[model samples]
Target: MRPADHDELNRLCKGVKKSFVHLETRDSYGTEVELPHMATWRRGEPDDFAWLGWWLEMLRGHRAAGRTCRRARVVSEPVSDYQRWTMSHVGLFTDAGEDIRYVARPRLATVPLPGSGDFYVFDDELVLFLHYTGNGTNLSFEITEDDRTVRTCREAFESVWALAAPLHAYRSE
Candidate 1:
């Protein structure tokens, strides 16, 4: 990496500090998003447009902030080629210095599609409402002075992250 590249990388990691909040469920990837909040339950299938669009927006936002975001999905079953493809697209952005991240950590956490999760970026007071449900899933959120929930959520994310496998670990067909 060049000098600028190194600086950018530093900035990216800086976004994830001790205060980032994250919410994931038992069916982390399968939970249905309520279109209203970022919590998960149980679900049938993944919403293609919603999932894809969320990835796109997240990548753009992270890129805008000069940082990278890594995702680890622990599913009950193996992911399909199509699912892998969607994930790969996010990975491509990381190649462009956008810091894209994805992983398949089976059985770690589960959240139904259309559920909600929040991530609070500590340094900048950025709280991301992550809703993975509905036709046009929205991660509607607000920044608040209360950091308790955010802190807990971030800890949860780290717990899952610790157990998650790297994207390269899985060989997609």
Candidate 2:
């Protein structure tokens, strides 16, 4: 099922009961809400990061409710400018109770991933695939509850997560 809008996606994510695991394979994302901040970063300007309040609050709520949220990012070594910038601010997410990790692309050569894009598995039962354009603009969200697909994505996320390092300890070497 395709989420009708961003709000629908947020509702689905908010409804996750036990766990929310995400696998992000993109080097950069051109999200409208983030682009301006990224530009400011590129210019060496300071940002208050107030825009992340909503997301951090949600993570806090999930944590308070005993729900676990994890994210594993597969990135190329010598990360892109976007990834570098993102990593710099990852503390906000971590501090808010999200477990975010990173794995170099080379480390996944021997691993089998379910698909070629990004996805989120909620409660290990629903899979939300994120479709993006070549330039890293999000296109749509497709959700599925098919057991096989969910299992494959969950396993793939775990495989990558196992090889990942916490963002604070990650080095691009």
Candidate 3:
């Protein structure tokens, strides 16, 4: 079946019991929602962070309800302008209750990772793989209830997660 839209990808997170984990491997992200602000950031100009944005608000609510939400981004060294921009907001994400970490791609030479796309594993049951267009545009996603997919992704994510530096220690970005 076709995966859900990005907006619908997180319903499982809310339904999760233990944790909702995200793995991001892209150097950049493209979405109409944040394009303007991202452009302003690249220009080195002040931009609105829109703390009340839906994503952050949702995270806050999840946290308030005692659910743990976390994300790990595998990025390249000397981070791209987009990654750098995202790094600047690490605090915002964490403050909203996400435990964001950064993993250097080069360091994962021997590590097995999710191929092609990123995935979010909810309570170790649902696995949603996110796909993107060549231009970094958000495209689509595929979710699987397959035990093998979920188990393998959770293992890969955990392995990378173990080596990832907490946002505060991840100064390269």
TM-score per model over all chains? 0.46, 0.95, 0.90
C-alpha RMSD by candidate, in order: 11.5, 1.4, 2.0
51-150 per-residue lDDT for model 2 (tens digits): 9898999999999999999999999968999999999899999999999999999999999997657998989888888888999999888888999999
- Considering TM-score, where higher is better, how would the candidates rank from best to worst? 2, 3, 1
Angstrom error at residue 131, model 3: 0.7
Clashes of each: 29, 0, 0
Q: What lDDT tens digits, residue by residue, belong to model 1 across residues 1-173? A: 01223233234335454222233332333324333122211233433445445445655665566554554444334654334434544454445334322344443446222234433344444444444444333324434434654454555666666655545654541
Preferred candidate (TM-score higher): 2 or 3: 2
Where is model 2 more than 4 Å wrong at Cα?
1-4
| Candidate 2 C-alpha error for residue 137, in Å | 0.4
Could you tell me the lDDT of residue 17 within candidate 2?
Answer: 88
Best by lDDT: 2
Q: Is candidate 1 or candidate 3 better by TM-score?
A: 3
Q: Which residue pairs in candidate 2 collide?
A: none
Among these predictions, the greatest TM-score belongs to: 2
Which portions of model 3 show Cα errors greater than 4 Å?
none
Per-residue alpha-carbon lDDT of model 3 for 1-173, expressed as tens digits?
A: 35687556757765778788899998988878677887887788986677447678878888988888988899987788888888877788788888999989998899998785588999888888888897788778888889998999999988988989987787744
Native-to-model Cα distance after best TM-score fit, residue 168 in candidate 3, in Å: 2.0
